[model samples]
Target: MGGINLNGLFIKPPSSLLAEAYDALDPNGNITIKWDIISWTPDGYVAVVTMFNFQQYRHISAPGWTLSWTWAKKEVIWTMMGGQATDQGDCSRYKTSPPHCCKKTPSIVDLLPGTPYNQQIANCCKGGVINSWAQEPNNYGSSFQLSVGAAGTTNKTVKPPKNFTLLAPGPGYTCGPAVVGHPSKFISQDGRRVTQAMMTWNVTCTYSQFLAQKTPTCCVSLSSFYNETIVPCPTCTCGCQNNDTHPGSCVNPRSPYLASVVNGPGKNSLTPLVQCTKHMCPIRVHWHVKLNYKEYWRVKVTITNFNYRMNYSQWNLVVQHPNFDNLTQIFSFNYKPLTPYTSINDTAMLWGVKFYNDFLNQAGPMGNVQSELLFRKDKSTFTFEKGWAFPRRVYFNGDNCVMPPPEAYPHLPNAGSRLKFSIFIFFMTSLTLFFLFE
Candidate 1:
């Protein structure tokens, strides 16, 4: 028999395809968790765990990352530096100086800044906030040291942790099982000495926008000086403005209780409480074709926040357009070129300048920041017609925004129609002259 039969139903081995998270602009983006056993203790071992954010634009923000995993063989944390477990689960078994954590599954968070000297390690603090590899390569990783009591002391006896999970303050990342890899090597800061670890393992995690949120956090609008019509963000691009069913979904700009609502405890919740608008999006990106010049063209970009309670700090925007390669100057924002595709140099990462526009404030009059870009025109491929000046794609804080339909974009005035009218006028004038002369 090819399969087993139960109650007239044939059963066979199970198999199915797995769904994966992918981004066209950032196809190779991921976070790697590395665990290296630096020393062997009497009972167990001491290991250093580090996290590296390899994504091009995505970063872990304040109230930062949380890393968790299930130990393979009854591991208990005896001591920790640079980070700590969220719980001291059932340390009651040890009466005198109990283990730092006594749990099979543990969640760890990075120690905040200004930690005591004894508790600090290299790349340890900053509240677990990590920038993307492209934006801040120097600050792209976080590290912590931990001493385990029950884990095996020898490399052969030790096993890797399972079910690793990463929440960079929130879900969207899916981690794979930790597997042993080549030994890790460490070098002294002075670059004079080096040391090698006895064992090492790694866990890689990928993010999925679909798993993160159903609705987009931002939207893009378009406008041009040549056309009077402005294409607005798509209606309900983020969510519908439902009042009766979900009273707390959004707040009116003029609501008297706005202050109390925004300052309430629920303000810190994961879901954003945005200002009521047609788009109902927390953030809006407006791109305007401001001016046209002989050799260079100008475009103005504006980012506005509608969230009542939250402020976006260390935020960044990514834009893709053909003219980015010829970009001359950006007015206020600091920019860095991102060459994810390698062959295409059209992507750019822009962020607010520190101490001025770095912090995007809550929904109000002062909630927006803007910058203007000047780009040298490439005569071979440059054209104002058919919305050629508009960006091909836009992303805010690494999350893609919904773009308005191409047909709705403002079009150039019909030059062909004017030419037709001029020809008809000339034909009428010639016919009148001939008839008069005859």
Candidate 2:
């Protein structure tokens, strides 16, 4: 699914774009939308629509998913539950009882929590958020039921909706044309009987990072106690500052309007009004080589959120390091190994514990999460020489962070020669002293 721009062959895509194009762990990852009509109405039919996230790592965060499609016929939504249309549309045509929505192209958003029980159904009222398959498989899907009117009651007469679009809070997913598939099977809650949908149509959507953003979201920095130097994020790794419009300028931390702007409308949106910095990244990951033990080594990782406008919930980090296979213990974070290359387990998925460090706050004193990783050393491969202790690649919430070059990493000091010479001189001095005393 990860392909170059057909029109612009000269352009080279970023490694993050290519590295995430396919998930070896889940080859058929996608968010599938299914419209399953259960019963035929006098005018139309009742459909129970389901949106399932089969993607292993990608999830729909706050201000969740907004699903839209163009109705094939003059179909108007009569009643809806579990979700509501953003617009009621023009219902003036009906004098007595207006349909829930009367638009030819209706946009629907999931209802928030605490919805009325009568208006709720299975897997509804999550404020539009959907978890990824691997992180929380049980919450990977959401469902809503709706009543349709002014449409054919039979499957042969009814045509499937077209031009499905998914705004998982933002643009990046492209959905294919709805294709009628095998009838979906349903069962009673008590497990007494089984039922099947009258008709079923599915829409599978894939993601492309190129369509998501022009700039990177996060970056990485490094430090080690052995060396005084602390490597910073590469210049303009996310984006560079400019003297032009608001795009380049950052919000002042003490600005008077800060309160209003951040808590204003669309508070849950992904917009980042971050602080001023050379890297201009919304998030920064700092890895410090903390302590070394005879049989083990420890590393401290800190994730700081510079985005003052948004808060990250259920955030996760993906890292690639050869030592992850030898990971012995991790503090304040949960770890899961990923084997994308069959047997090689150099990759790891780490996230904060539930209700603890799971929420990465906005830019402030409390806007960071820290964890210590301890790994058992393999004498053959464990060495402080060069940059062997650092991670090969790091990702923050699925965004690849720019790391300092190999040459810039903290290098081990070459003090072995000085120690050897000093030992030789000491031995010579001891021999002379012994001869004089004799």
Candidate 3:
């Protein structure tokens, strides 16, 4: 280079910004400030203060000293345009005396699962143009700053960091609507296979994703089958015929079957209407619930509506969880439903309820009851909010047996009795048809 004279100078150092207290974010992606200041004047610049890293330094630049800056580490003069150049005794090269504390960046920390955190960085420069630095943690955490300039400052923030927690399906969960039969029914078709069913789950971003990925199909392994047989038409007259009725001893309407279930949440009631047919009885019920994953870890489900209907019609329900064992329960109030009927699940920390009514053979009064349950794990416990009922869906499964035709109506010996039957025949016929089609 030809002879060059310097009028002013600036310096730039490599620096980066990083989360001061990050749980697991790497340091490379952060931004940093790199800068230096200088002056060139005949007085050789008497330094007042020195700022290392965040610290400040003496006054920079003078009337005669023109200043410019670029990314290059060394000073690059744009032109010899300034007045007279004077020796400034290298103002950029100042040293601190006495016991000096080494320059240090902000402190940081590693984040933990489900844990909340707070972090901040302060500006340390004494004077000069300093830009505010940006901070971004792995979780898009919030940022704050501390300053010594103001006496009292107030801040308003919304949605502060929340605590972390893990949740699971309540105790004793199982899969319903297995390939073969109801809960008690075994997979006789296959080997005496003892499947230690454990729940597993995969999340889909959209409803389409759930369908495309076939999650419902893949999750079948978590289900189990059971046996339930519907008794063929066993007729019983409830005696109430349409107009001009004639009541008899044989035609009596029995009380409806009551179903009560107690689980993690609470108690729920269901009234099942009995439909006695010449060959069998059938009922339909549906239930759906959305779980709140933010609430608790485990949940429980218990069904108990099989008082009298159990003897005539065997029914069962299947309970399932994403990452847990499948439980199957028989709807026989006389005894415990079965081992497979109850469950608590944690597999994918899921939320939702699926109802498969009389999965094997549908024979019974039709209706259902759902209740809240409580779950516990370690020191934390969870329960459904008080008195919330799981919504129900009522429809017949395709496999359930239909009621008998009305042609099999009981024949009477006297015309009066026959005429009475005829009077009620139209109404009775309608009732019979409803069951048959159902």
Candidate 4:
């Protein structure tokens, strides 16, 4: 009777049914559950649940689960079955064993319900939730579990290295005479005045991430005599040789002739003295005398590695000037000039130079490299003696070199005056000695 009833009912034992259900519900039995905090906000956090060995239990739906954060004292319940569900008949009702499933492959479920609980939890947290998908979280979950098994949490934090600093061309850095120009008002129109100058410097960053990022930038404000008016040249005449076309011979040609013959080129024949006051009247003659002439300038720039720990792979230096057209030569052993020399624009003249490989190879911590630029005008007899202008914009790896108060004019000796002074001193000394001996 029992066998006949069992065959008619087609019933499986209660123990066997319970065992199957238990194994299906146990994550370790047929599936593995991995829980991770994918992202979070100040109020709440988002968790991810992954299931492995999902194919083994293709008939079973993903179990309902609960995620809890101990710090915020919050809990989120996810009741959706198999993450999605269809109104299919029960598998136990069929005699063909386990029934077909909605999701038959391994799956991942983002546990963010977008509910008030998630929002409230996020608000309760101090800082915004950090996404731990790429990195581990600083704070660990007190306890985490899926309906099937408990999951582990990765609790780790990352700190960035120290920031990089520019040491060589520190604050108030200046480049000496990168551009040469006359310091007088007479040659102002000739563009011999140092209108602008540019300087290059060194920069560094501690993080390696800077390599691929945009280069750092710094602003250097230039304070110069940009607004000063050009002083007019003093009035004078060319001694006996009347340069003006106003046809009129000197009343006393012998006096003017004697002045020119005695003055020569070293002395200013046009200068008025009390002895020649009568004959030194203003004449309508313009002497094409190039006064306050500046012939050449030596520009020196130094780049130093500021960071003691980091080494530079390569670097670019750019300098701009308004009067760079006077550049005659470069004196540098470490740097190489870039192509397309002296790029000119309406604003200024740009010079790009690169230092790498051999230059950087030997440059260790606190290493320095020096470069010199020689600027000259057409005339070799004159130079920007009073003081040449510096560059207006100087950049090192796109960082500007700052300028302090303008320095005093460089000491430039006048060759003609120096020779004349030496002669006068020798003559005076000989005369004094002769008188003393007599």
Candidate 4 residue runs with Cα over 4 Å from true position: 1-297, 333-366, 379-386, 407-438
lDDT of 3 at 16: 31
Candidate 2: minimum summed lDDT over ten consecutive residues — where?
Answer: 5-14
Give the winner by lDDT: 1
Candidate No. with top TM-score: 1
Structural similarity to truth (TM-score) of each candidate: 0.89, 0.85, 0.15, 0.26
How do the residues 1-438 of candidate 3 rate in per-residue lDDT, one tens digit apiece? Answer: 121111111112223322331111122221111111112223111111111121011011101011111111122111111011122223233353311111111111111222322221222111121111111001111111111111111112111111111010011111111021111111222445432111111111101112222111100000001112222222331111222452221111352322321111222212222332221122322222323334233223323222223221122222222312221221221111112112434211111132333223212233343333322223232222221222111111101112223232222235676578777988899999999999
The better-scoring model by lDDT among 3 and 4 is 4
Task: Please say which candidate is ahead in TM-score: 3 or 4.
Answer: 4
**On a 0 to 1 TM-score scale, where does candidate 1 land against the true structure?**
0.89
C-alpha lDDT of all candidate models, in order: 0.87, 0.83, 0.21, 0.29
Clashing pairs in 1: none
Tell me model 3's lDDT, rounded to 2 decimals.
0.21
Residues 206-285 of candidate 1: C-alpha lDDT, one tens digit per residue: 88887777779899999999888999999999998988888788999898998898888786786789999999999999
Off by over 4 Å in 3: 1-315, 320-374, 377-438
